[model samples]
Target: KMFACEHEGVTPDILVLGKGMTGGYLPLSATITTEEIYGAFLGEYEEFKTFYHGHSYAGNPIACAAARGSLEAFRNNDTLEALKEKVAYFEEELKEFEGLPHVGNVRSKGLMAGIELVVDKESKDPYAPETAVGWKVAEHAMEDEVLLRPLGNVVVLMPPLGIPMDDLKKLVRVTYESIRRATEGKPHNGNP
Candidate 1:
């Protein structure tokens, strides 16, 4: 919906979609466009206006079957509605970690979130890149059996959408503990 709204004017000549399109099971992508674009290539056989592009396995029947089943599951089970409720609960729980000593901000939408960490809250000074604070937090989380990835000093969370509320709570808890462990006793103001 957001993409449609943002690209309203530019009637897409080609639409390419991949990653999470089929729930990330089998790596597949698609290109879709109006018949008008396809008709543009309707010319003499000698004419070289035909655009040709192909993947090694462009139309694997099994992948198509999986995509079809996934779509049906989405409609029949209202997976999106359930996801909305879960994301709402998750975001509300994430808010509890705000205002922590090293946590600069918590921003989230749907099932994704980024927790930015800073050395100082007043000036919003990020930890030195050499310190690799985000990496440390991610490593600590892994030690606690919570896998996480960091983008720069921002800890990103993209947990599975269907995680139960209890597991979600544990995820948040482990994330908080990991951050605390990483930054604890470290000088926030670059002083001893």
Candidate 2:
């Protein structure tokens, strides 16, 4: 999609950018808004309409340069164009999770995806937080040299845009194995 908002044909009043903005090489964030919204903070001091948002880490020259270079790499390498094939392949690979016994949902956009694990597929009952089922899957994945982060019972998989196809395949394969090992082998009720 051209923009996340554009996917739904909507324009948000405010937008925030972080994470991949600097290609994960630095810490940075940005706030973007429509001109009309900016005008709201343009009034006189007595009006008390000013927006006084600031942070000590708001701007760093090195981070800005990294962001610029990251953007240049995107353009120079046609990264987005190249991502189409990878995203399609990723979606296909993710289908392997849907048939897994404990996976209740597999949702994705672009290269980012989450596999939601459930205690019961029919009821979609989530495992208790103490179970740390997500972490269990991650631990298994780590053994295979694939790092993943889990949000509760949902294991998130977000590979780099420039990740090679072979690595992407391994990521999915390892994650699939990890999920199986964590959910299918033994009873994990209230345990890791």
Q: Which residues of candidate 2, in runs, are more than 4 Å off?
A: 43-49, 186-192
Q: CA lDDT of 117 in candidate 1?
A: 93
Q: Which lDDT value does model 1 have at 54?
A: 75
Worst 10-residue lDDT window, candidate 1: 183-192
TM-score of each: 0.75, 0.90
Task: For each candidate in the order shown, give its overall lDDT on alpha carbons.
Answer: 0.77, 0.88
Predicted structure with the largest TM-score when compared to the true one = 2
Error of 2 at 126 (Å): 1.4
lDDT of 1: 0.77
Output the lDDT of residue 121, model 2.
Answer: 88
